[model samples]
Target: MKELSTLCYIEKDGKYLMLHRTVKGNDVNRDKWIGVGGHFEKNESPEECLLREVKEETGYTLTSWQYRGIVTFVYGEDTIEYMFLFTADGFEGTQISCDEGELEWVEKAAIYDLNLWEGDKIFLRLLEENHPFFSLKLVYDTDDVLQYAALDGKRLWL
Candidate 1:
């Protein structure tokens, strides 16, 4: 199966908004900390998907954001997800309860301490460093352990 999605890290005061995936029982990301965003609806552009997903999940309309990267996630042999990654610095709205999980503004450095997927650590670090727009591919086994990783067409680990 193949999927297209958007994910964004909204930043303010040296922190990023993060979601703790604790609400869904069958979620692939259960107990994991991740950014806000979701799959694209038919007829939606990446920007439209980003805006809609972020608004739905976080109750904030992004006023300023950057297309940071693209992450191709390969889960074993059957499932692949192409994710549009974004970073937003400006937004306005009152926060609300998210049905998907609890939302928290975590310190940038502290995010590394969260329960995140290994591949997420890689891309999160790239975002923190303000790296140039990139393409990252991450492959994982059934156990969810990262098996391979590449950055911008250069193999980094395996």
Candidate 2:
């Protein structure tokens, strides 16, 4: 199945809101740290999905956000997910508990210390470097090991 989704990194004081995926069973992202977002609802645009997902996951209304990139995830050949990536510098609302996992504001510099998808490290670095809107393709084996990577159509060293 080709799934469409959105993921956002909301920033405040050098920290980004992160979700530790520990709550769900049989979750591909179990025990991994990731940004907030989810699959698109019926006829929802990327922006629309982003806004709704952020509110649902963090209880925050985004005041300002930028589309960062598109990540094409090839999970074991058949499970492909095109994830719309975003970075938000402005938002307003109180945080809430997420049923998907525990939420925490993690320092950007310390993020690498956490357990993360290998492909995520690449895109996160791009986000940290303020790279322009680009496309990243990450192919992973059934075991979730990153097998290949590309940026803007060019293959990257794994």
Candidate 3:
């Protein structure tokens, strides 16, 4: 089955709001630190999904955000996901406790030290570089190991 989702990295000062995916027992991202987002609701546009998810997950309404890229995740032979990526620098509201996991502002440089999917590292680099909007495809084995990566149809060695 194919799924559509949105992910947002909210930046403040020199840190990014991150979620530690430890509360969900069956989560695909269990124990990993990742950006905020979730699956798209019926008929929701990317921006709509981004705004709703940001609010639902982080309790912040995004006032300024950039549509960063589209990421296609191929998981073995069973599932495919198109994830719309975003980054936000402006928001309003008091942060609330998330039911999904603990939320914290992590130093951008220290994000790499956390447990993350290998393909995430690649896209994180792209985000850091302030690259133009692009498309990325990440293929993973059944074990969730990143096996191949491509950006805009061009194969990436890493």
Off by over 4 Å in 3: none
Expressed as tens digits, the lDDT of each residue in 95-120 for candidate 3 is 99888999999999999999989999
Could you give me the TM-score of model 1 versus the true structure?
0.98
lDDT of 2 by residue, 114-151 (tens): 99999999999999998999999999999889999999
Model 1: weakest 10-residue lDDT segment is 149-158
Query: CA shift at 144, candidate 2, in angstroms?
Result: 0.4
Model 3 pairs whose backbones collide? none
Put down candidate 1 lDDT per residue, 1-158, tens digits, no spaces. 99999999999999999999999999999999999999999999999999999999989999999999999999989999999999999999989899999999999989999999999999998998889999999999999999999999999964
Which stretches of candidate 1 lie above 4 Å from their native place?
none
